[model samples]
Target: MKTGLREKLKWLRKPDSTPATADNTRATEPDRPGWFIPQKAESLLATPLRRQLMKIIWQRTSVSAALFAELYQTPVARFAVLAQQLPASEYHHHAYPGGLLDHTLEVMAFAAKLRQRHLLPAGAAPEDQAREAEAWTAGILYAALLHDAGKLAIDMEVTTGENQLWYPWQGAPAGPYRLKYRKGREYALHPVAGCLLATRILPDSALNWLAQYPELMASFLYCISGQYERAGVPGEVVQEADRASVAQYMGASAGSVLDNPQPSLAKQILTALRELMHTRYRLNNPQSGSDGWLTADALWLVSKATADNVRAWLLQQGVTSVPDSNIRLFDEMQSLGLIIPTTEGKAIWTCDIQATGGWSPGRPLTLLRVSPERIWPDADGRPPVFDGRVSPLSSVPEQPQACGDAPAMSPVDPGTGTGGDLLSELTLSLFSGTDDHTAPQASMTPPSGSEEKHIAGDGLLTVVPAETESQPPPVTEVNPPVPASITPPVAACSGQNFTDWLREGLLTRKILINDRLARVHMVEGMLFLVSPEIFKLYVQSTTGSTGDEWMLAQKAFQKLGLHHRGVNNINIHTCQIRGPRRNSRVKGYLLTSPEQIFGESIPEDNPYLSVLEEGSGTAT
Candidate 1:
């Protein structure tokens, strides 16, 4: 029997119901295009992480931009539309307000990597195998992308920006939209929804091509319908990819056995810390009771206490598969740059933290001395250093710091649960996809391209303004305030704030203005902010959304009356910095007062900055 030819799929189980069909034709304009804040898919996909995934797809399938459009791009565009800002799960891995897009992109990447291993037409003639390779590759990518497509059907009531309840059966929702999860809704039935909506997104031409391969077609359909038993390799691959994706978010090895010594894990320790600081955990509480304490220059936490607290919180939130051991958890945290190391370069710091009347004799604590800006934007009033001495642990706890021992989820049995039904979770834990008896993954060789390596001990390679620490409530930049004055209450992404960040960067030594090609520098005790370079930094910090973002920032900066213009009626001044090859002009602002940013103790002028006088053309 031809797949998708059935009047109604057995899985969909709605003989009387019509399947949802989106207009596969691309929309020239979306319904209510700018209803809510629009997240441009092109921008979202252009991020460093997604860019790598797209590159992987192109490499694995040898897909050019044209070929990708013919096969995958159309549906991807549609998926992005319908699922605008829709999260993957309500309380799971990507439980954030808008995590669906990131999650979907991840699974597709995993599936693409998995697709490279298999020979399509598994046991067919060599000629047939060669003929269907691209088709097979396309099938896997579409299946992975569509795996969670049905999520919109049963899980939530999604509406476009205009308050229309757009249904997937009708096609991708017309325009701007948001989603709220359904209470007491059946979670697993979405696989059926995926089947109904798959055709709406997958172009008819691609389907016609896929129909030529029966085994591949059947397996792909079964996986879409949430039937792994029949999905065979496709289903298994999706299952593993899903688990691996979740593991990456959970900071756990993707899939590991309870008794096994080694496991494939996902690493997002820094993202996790970021999430905690933003949503759940609180840091630097000076009060008697708090999650952790913040000092003059560092954040201090009880080592075992924080580990236990994080583990318990993750488990409660349904991230059941995580680093089971405190040591492993600490390893990820330290590696992700989330925690500070001791003087001896150890994750666990032996420090005696004293808060008021209570003090631990000397316990093994975690000393995390991150920048103040990282945890809070406008935090003020630095507290004195802890009044205590370093001592040794006087006693061992009952479990000695609950490492991997939280109520961890067990590895899922693929055969036991239905793929689409959330009647109960399928339980694809850390060790689900890699069974010893399973067929080997497609390639053993690491691809020529690799992800950017991060030495969490080090920081971001790019110094964008948005990533800068210590943005407080904006205040008057009109007069230079002392460094100890107060945190301003400015919009974090504003141009004025960008200048403020430059000032703070100078103060904290986070930015190197003295270096050649630096955007901001001090010259003649006045703030010199390089024009386009500094603006680019500001745009990147605010939104990596558009190429034109900097133009807006430039306009915003001009609105701030900080720069002093010369008699030429130009606030921007050109300067000549000498290099071995030649001399070139760099344009920036000369702040009216250094006290506005540098405050009471302004630094001396940079001897390297040679400001060009009005009407001065070439450097002699």
Candidate 2:
């Protein structure tokens, strides 16, 4: 379908909609221009590759010029020049020598465009920005010029099966028989090698900085390797620009007809540019994970709800599909407030505090009065008065801890009972009669032993709704002076051994796979393996894994028992806790695979910490 600039702009204007068409097109085309472009590519093949590299470099601080020059060597350039001079066959897309050069130029052009957009004119040369722009231009240009540089050093031969070619870098024929060899065996490693070779030549060039910022370099190469998927928007632009340029030339030369409208191309260019902007912004202002940092939930409430209902209003506008996890938390000070409905409707909302201590079960909480100059205490001490909204309640019950026997706490299914509405019930819990209703209260503690790895231990301590009707006031004064020290089981593990580490890792985060093995991936610590038997048992008991395959595997593992067979060890490096996979040994053995478990650093936002007293008992 033909989409107009107005229609495309309409989607971009809405955050909830996310403009999938724009994003997808930006991700796929390489000839599209960008808001930032470092330099122009000398050739078509070079454009996509250069575009991809520029996208990557913009992710981090900055790139150096010395490092930029190193991406392409003379020999590689010579080869590309030769390739470009050759006549392309009907089946060969980029089979000529200069193909690499063509891609490199396009990437450079896109990057040049992007640089012009973000950086100021006064800082354009020799300075870091200039060097960054230059080096970025150079590196991408090099990646484009050399991605297929090895092709110049090889030859293609048509055979019975399919077209086969030989590559000098891989020492194998890139032909019909071996797709990997033809495409580039050690395909993932070529860009690295290319960068190294390019560096040797341009020792003082801008790209040498890439060695220091490897992720940026890697991200650039990865985009091309995925051909765009792995590459974020900036990277995608490189790809899109390269493709667009080639398609334009190819169609022009062949007199081939296109089924699409010309405006589609412009739409694609704009989308890629937007994505590039989004990616750079995210990299520049990453979510902070420091002490006194805002929790994701709290941040969401403050930013989205109270901040002029910007979030809800945006959501209603079909702009973004932000999940709850994207929310953040803050421990700063502000006027006391409660979340009450704006109207008599059952819907509840957060609002400023009109007075302290007036909470009712069914009645909706509401207060529109703004307290802009309210003083508040932060984690450190009295900072300044915060103009923002504070959480209605500082403490709320956390999700269930992973006690081996604790039944998974399942909220009513969204599809069932009033669409799983809990406004009335949750509101009652928040306000239950009180004079201190505006103050933050301690969250109900999870039962002790809820985090125990084995079920044989005493049953976990849990909070069932209090059966009695009478209760104390809900609110506690704001920033009530810091309390005396309280020992928490989780806190005690600061200097623990491997077993303790394993327990903590498993209990805190959801299970993840590493190298096909099942184990919990930690954010900043070593990966640990709970006994596979216990792991399996826990999964079955908690409904962590489902389906017939999982159920059948549970039965087999049950039968297998805890006895030491050939596979007793749960390699933390190889463990995986993903969904069902085929088992060659036993149809439903449910064994972990090597690819499933990639090491993940421990999460900064721990799920085990208690919310009641910032650093109270752990395993809440």
Candidate 3:
């Protein structure tokens, strides 16, 4: 064997020097700063949750514990020490004491599971793949663990009890430390910052092993550096795993393997609305002000108030993924079929409100109209409907008649007793199997090292089952039939069709622009569509295409000649995203003319974004 491979084998076989006893190895108690003192790899892995996760990782690798210890455990120990009770975000997923560590371990396991589905070095021969399998697996695990390490370096300000600022380069803090997120931090800079600390967390031996494989090393660098658009399979697996961890922590299922699906954001929105209605929202109040009016046909909510409340409520409940902009939230709601759209397929409705008791707004108020049946499925559980009628000044566009449309409620007739029984039957039909209550958000507190098992079976820290371990029955075969009206029709697939669809979706607010989650942004008075993401979304929605099919769509779109080319005639352009604390670069395609996409009247340019000139930076 070559010296390098021989050395790696020797390193993997070396026995751990630390004792295996939990009491001796694990720092079961926190210090004065409420941070666990740095412990050995075995000690850090002593917790039930971490141990369970380590077992899953081992199962995925099918490797001996000694090999696993050298490759996985050592780096994870370093990461845990560096992470030290830091929350993943200010108020997002895994936002609690020691959340960063838990999230990282989860991602490592999840990524391992996801990695089993693929043959690495992408197009390599089977023999080559088999030979390099262990290297690729290690690369994936390292990539997953370090993916968010940059957040600790850049996004936060960590201080020791002596008021000393601690950097990740200095290694884990020598003593107790506290951290606070920097104000106005650039959202996209952490990935770039993470690249700086990769060498610190990963040992030199592992790095040297991975460096032998050029393609794997390149992909690993791209992934840890946060340029996922160029990272290929490694990037995709890590990102999917990260999303799954975040989804589960935020009380949602990570939908589908291989496909990057949007988490159940709509369900969370509806759940928030339901909670607010029960606790804080005042509906149909006569003597005092009301948040909304519930009528026989619809529930008309004040647009601005409803948006603000829902956004706040979701955030408080640990759903930090909610859009900051009301317009984006409204667009999401409408697109997800949670709210009835206006005649022009808009989310907001201009309406005049006049109560029977001579209470009326001075001018028309913008509102959101929701079908009552959506909120109150059981008639008996619903509050009394408004005595006064809610007349819509602007009518909603009629949808195509479908078998799934809820039977329209007839005029309430007390003598005949019609609507109640019908609504009860509809309630049973609509929500037969689903739970009415929202899944509890994961706890912010880290699981105790001493605990043998999770107390709550369905708690926030619930372990997501490995996909490869078992194949559940097909959802369509097992689950009850879903109504067709809820699922929107897929647009015809083509490059021209995609552009046309984009233009129309933007115009109609079905596709959002200039928001945090938005794929299309206005830059230099032209449209800057984030590459691969926008294309992947189009292909996924329309035809569920993967791999080369996505590339074909991009090439097809390029053939249209509507996009501005970068240096070396590259189709991708880099834009500098300037924020208060720092700046970051994003890769995307710049349209040649705003008029081509948005016609004459284009939206204002996103203030934070500026298109970089050709040759300004690397283009993917």
Candidate 4:
């Protein structure tokens, strides 16, 4: 099958007439009409790197150039015309001229590689798989190519000749165009917008062919629409491939890109919170407008106030990526395990505060519950625990899930014995999205085998729910303060030191394991460290260095020969996260010897995580 395509396309292979150089020169030449030299799509894509990428893409198809051209090249050309010199992001990945095109092409190539490993129509018979293989491949390619095409529509204001407004839906510009990123643009809006512009980039023939396969078409649509959670395997393949491309450009690897860490954002947030708590925030005050109340078990911060202040603080500190919306900020905090969740797995809690001084809020206040230890790792630094009780009000009424079109299974609230409802109708009117806000929460019921368990070994906290109502629930430390004695006093940062620090942190409960936001996971009787993240955390903690320095630590760790390299000598390994609803993948480095970190007492393998065999077709 491959030979036939190669033979037919042999004549198409030819040397480039002009020497290849970076196309970014054209992007920055001039925004003026006189200097804006419009070029043909084919000519624009004639650069050596783009030509080579196209060749790789065609090779992955294993089809004749004529057939592949009609299927892929045509659409790519159309995309080039529209994307000409546009960047992928303002200040992030591929933020150069023609970066968007390069990133898209790279993603397509990477997706092609990943597609070979999966037999599409998932559980279909071999005959069916063979029959639908090409369609599935095309679907994956189309999904990857058009993944970020919506950026043209939503992120930028485009003007053609004579300052004429240009819309992507109106087709490629016939004359010179000027483009500028929109200020205060929603970072996530482009994904959905991409769906609308798909028809403009993709030919009807290709779309019709893709539409023939219902399952593939659905996934393709979902992916382009940015509903990855619903897109199934196809979405995952596109996401991973996209990550690989981004990682390559960002000077990281696929493994680290698997779960791209916001290197300084998390640290910045924590720092801001610490500063706010220390200076501006009024805690445990009986006054009605006090910033928060710190009880024995949890620190309850007023939701809106804290989010607003944190965002303002970060913005003032020159962190522009902080979410403008309070809901998104809350979600970010919860995802980072900075806040303790309610029984319904939500970040914001509706509680009534009754202070010992006979001062009480007349109405229920929306608050974020944070574990005390996360704020004050040293017990001596904490303020005296509050003497009053903070009881949750009755469960709020469930609202429609705004994030998705359909309603998912509502998790029952442990406090009310019913599904927790929408925050909008209650105090969180501004927050309108799915109620699945995950964070750490102490369960009232006994732990189930299926539930995530925290074991105290190597400094991990073994949190046992308090037996009495009077006693406070023990909090598990997420980011504990590193101790001086744990280090060997080498003073130099090295791989051994990183590992030693990790081991000591786990043992001392300075670093959390098996938590929602944890970077380390026990899988297949070995330790899986989420790359770049764990390394970034170590770098940030030890040297307080940022930006690409973690790569040094990663290289140092690789030299120790502690990690098992995967196919193509990939340092990152894939782990399947088996959840109650669906299964997902996590990429990291698996330790060659778990004993090196844990010694004789190895913790139980994370029940939710199972390492996937490299290049394996199956999840297990």
Query: What global local distance difference test value does model 2 have?
Result: 0.28
Q: Candidate 4: deviation at residue 244, Å?
A: 1.7
Alpha-carbon lDDT of model 4 = 0.64
lDDT of 2 by residue, 1-620 (tens): 75432233333332221111111111222233221111112342244333333334333214343322223333233333233333221112332333344444433443434333343222345454543443344444444444444333332222212344433333212222211112223434433344333432222323334443454566556543444455443354454344433443222111111111112212222222222222211111122211111221222122211221222222211112112111110000110121222233212233332212232222212222222121111223222222232344322322222213222222212112221123224222322232111111111122334232222112222232333222223422211111112112123222222234334334322222222223332211222233333333232222212112222332333343322222333211122222255311101112222122233323332222111211232211
Question: Which 10 consecutive positions of candidate 4 have the poorest summed lDDT?
Answer: 435-444
lDDT of 2 at 605: 25
Candidate 4 deviant stretches above 4 angstroms: 1-35, 254-620
For candidate 4, the per-residue lDDT at 414 reads: 14
- Using TM-score as the measure, name the better of candidate 2 and candidate 3: 3
lDDT of 1 by residue, 1-620 (tens): 52332222233332223222233333344555324444545644554444555555565567667766556666676677566667787645665544676677667766776666677767788877776777788788888888888897888787765678878767555555666666556656887678887767776666766776788899889988988767866776776677656655553432321111222122233334444444444443333334456666666655544554455444322243445456666665665555665555556544445555564323344344455555443454233344433342333222223233323223222113232322112222322243221111112111244221111112222222332222223311112111111122234336666777676555433344655535666766667777555654444333222133454566566667777776646666766776678756666678869788877767666676677776866532
C-alpha RMSD of each candidate structure in angstroms: 24.3, 27.2, 21.7, 21.3
Give model 2's clash tally: 112
Instruction: Give each model a TM-score.
Output: 0.40, 0.23, 0.46, 0.45
TM-score of 1: 0.40
Worst 10 residues of 1 by lDDT: 476-485
Better of 1 and 3 by lDDT: 3
lDDT of 4 by residue, 1-620 (tens): 53343343345444322211213223344555433545568777886556656877888788877788877988898888778777786645665567788789878977887778689889999988987888899999999989999999899888876778888776666567766667557877888887886777777767777777799999999999999879888887887677656544442221221112223344446656776676556677665447778887888887655665666454333244555445556666766667777777767677877888788766677778988786676677678877688897668423112232222222222112111232112212211232111111122122343222231112233333343212112222112122232221134258788888788766533454665556787887888887546775565455333334566576667778888766766666777777689876766688868989988868788888887776884556
Candidate order by lDDT, decreasing, is: 4, 3, 1, 2
Residue-level lDDT tens digits of model 3 in 183-299: 557878998777887777887777877888999999999999999879888887887778656655554432211111223676567766765665556677654446788987889
What lDDT does the true structure give each of the candidates?
Answer: 0.54, 0.28, 0.64, 0.64
Which of the numbered candidates is closest to the native, going by highest TM-score?
Answer: 3
